[model samples]
Target chain A: DAGVTQSPTHLIKTRGQQVTLRCSPISGHKSVSWYQQVLGQGPQFIFQYYEKEERGRGNFPDRFSARQFPNYSSELNVNALLLGDSALYLCASSSPVYGGETEAFFGQGTRLTVV
Target chain B: EDKVVQSPLSLVVHEGDTVTLNCSYEVTNFRSLLWYKQEKKAPTFLFMLTSSGIEKKSGRLSSILDKKELFSILNITATQTGDSAVYLCAVNNAGNMLTFGGGTRLMVKP
Candidate 1:
């Protein structure tokens, strides 16, 4: 079975531009989450979607948004990107069973570099 | 605010040595704590700890959660060079959001 997979392994965009990153969760997974990891830092949660609905969101700005599809795939969009937005965007998926003890598996991540 | 803090930021030890990493968290309605190992790309799940005192072991790596003390520790015994990586700790709260610590970068020298 394939793990979480992300599209556009890398991207370079200019400031104020908009970019969309895609993720395909593992088969049978119902939850997809997005996270941002800056250089030398751990990933920070952005948004989590379960059953195609937004379940949780983090402290990210309004420019950052995400949505999960009916198939449990997800896309993370960042508008008006700034230099500070350059980082690795990771997609994670989990089954969300057994009272939330399920472990999340992550994708290789899309490395976005905003110039 | 909900926060997770990891100790010693980084470590370097010789192969065959043992090392311990610590994680402490302060969050509302705590549910579970997780450990991940990141090599160069993405992070891979290592362990998910909920109940306290019960140890979860995988090969040479082990972890234990302390809900009463609001902390957890990961131990690696007889470490090998392949153990070099950044170990991350995250806490899952009632809100279903994961708050991650800064992570400890471990470099096991051969």
Candidate 2:
């Protein structure tokens, strides 16, 4: 089976612009989560969607939002991006039978650079 | 607020030497802890620990969690150059959200 896949391996955008990153989860996986990893730091959770519903969200600002499609694929949207938003946005997918406690498989991630 | 902190932010060790990475977390409704190895692009899952005292092992890498102490340690024995990467520790809380540490950069020189 194919692992999780993310689009636009690298993206460049100007300040105040909007951008959207896409993620295709592994087949049979129902959970998709978004994380932002700044240079020299680990990833920070942004949001999680399971079964086409918003399961969880992090402390990120309202500018950051995400949604899961019926096919279980996910898209993370950022509006009016700031320089601080430049980072590697990773998408992780997992199959949690009990709603949690399961392991996750990550995609290569989308590198966003705000100019 | 949930937080995960890793010690010795970075380490340099010669091949065949051993290294230990530490992670401490303060999460309200702690559930489990996880370790991931990030080479350059993606992070691959290494181990997950929920119950204390039980050690999870994979080849030269092993990890143990101490729920009572709110910390976890990952040990790499006889490290190889292939083991060079950023070791990340994350705390998974009841919300199913993972709070990740800053990560420990391991440089194994041949």
Candidate 3:
């Protein structure tokens, strides 16, 4: 089976611009999560959606938002991007069964550069 | 606040050498601890440990979790250059969200 897949592997945006990154979860998976990874740092959680509902959210600001579709796909949107917003956005999918013990598979991630 | 911390922020070793990576976490409601290997863009899953004592092993890599001390260790035996990457430790809390550590950058020289 294919792993999690993300779209627009690379993106370049300007400050104050808005950007959207997309993710398609693995087949039969109902949970999709978004994370941002800065250079030389581990990924920071942004949002997690299961069954088309917001299940969990991280410490990100209002500028960051995400939603999941019925197909279990997800989109992460960042508004009024700042230079500090530049980072690699990752998407991971998991089957949260048996009390969230399932392993999550991650995508290659979309590299966003804001100038 | 839930947090995960990794030790020895970075390490350098030659091939065939063995290395042990450490991860300690403090979470409100701990569910599991995971290890991932990141090379360039993506992080590949290595192990998900929830129970203590029983070690999980794959090939030359192995990991064990200790819920009592809230720490885990990843052991890689006979390391190779291909084993070089950023090793990340993340904790799955009760909320089903993953909290990642700063990661340990490993460099294996031939």
Candidate 4:
């Protein structure tokens, strides 16, 4: 089966601008999560949505937000962009949340370059 | 605060050699530990360990978890140039949020 898919493989935005990234989870999956990975660092959790509900949030600022749809697709929105915001945004999907039984699958990620 | 740390930030090894990567974590609630291999693009899943002391293996790669120690180790044997990538360790908390380590860069020179 096709894994998680993300849109806009690469993006460039000016300071203070906003960008929205999109993700389509694998078929039959019900959870979507967002992560940000800076160069030389591992991905940091941003947000998680399951069944169209916000199940978890990370230590990121309020400028970052996300939502899940009925079909289990998800979107990550970042505002007030800064050069520090330039990183690879990753989308991951998993089957319905269970106790340690769910395995997350990742997408190629969207490279966001904020200037 | 929740945190995950990996040792040997980077390592260089010969193609036919074997290498081991380590990861340790501290969080309020423990759930599972996951390993991913990142090449030029996305990070792909390698293994997920929920129970302690059991080993997971796939070809030249294998991993083991130590719940009592709150850590995990990934081993790659008979490495090849294609095995060069960043190995990341992440822990899922009770909230279902994942906290990731800084990652270890492994270079397998042919």
Where does candidate 3 chain B have its weakest 10-residue lDDT segment? B90-99
lDDT of 3 by residue, B1-110 (tens): 99899988999999999999999999999888999999998899999888999899999999999999999999999999999999999999854479999999999999
lDDT for model 2, please.
0.93
What TM-score does chain B alone reach in each candidate, compared with the true chain B? 0.97, 0.97, 0.97, 0.96
CA lDDT of every candidate: 0.93, 0.93, 0.93, 0.91
True contacts kept of 4: 0.70
RMSD over all Cα atoms, model 2: 1.1
Summarize candidate 1's per-residue lDDT along A1-115 as a digit string, tens digits: 7989999999999999999999999999988989999999999999999999998999999999999998889999999999999999999888867656378889999999999
Per-residue lDDT of model 3, residues A23-103, tens digit only? 999999999999999998889999999899998999989999999988999999999999999999999988857655478
- Report the C-alpha lDDT of model 4 over A1-115, residue by residue, as the tens digit: 7889999999999999999999999999888999999999999999999899998898899999999999899999999999999999999988855444477889999999998
Q: What is the TM-score of chain B in candidate 3?
A: 0.97
Order candidates by DockQ, high to low.
3, 2, 4, 1
Off by over 4 Å in 2: A98-100
Model 1, B52-89: lDDT tens per residue?
99999999999999999999999999999999999999
Give the C-alpha miss distance for residue A57 in model 3, angstroms.
0.8
The ten-residue window of minimal lDDT in model 1 chain A covers A95-104
- Tens digits of per-residue lDDT, candidate 2, A1-115, equal 8999999999999999999999999999989999999999989999999899998999899999899999999999999999999999999998876646468789999999999
* Candidate 3 lDDT score at position A14: 94
> What TM-score, to 2 decimal places, does chain A of model 1 have?
0.97
Candidate 3 residues lying further than 4 Å off, grouped into runs, are none
lDDT, residue A63, model 2: 99
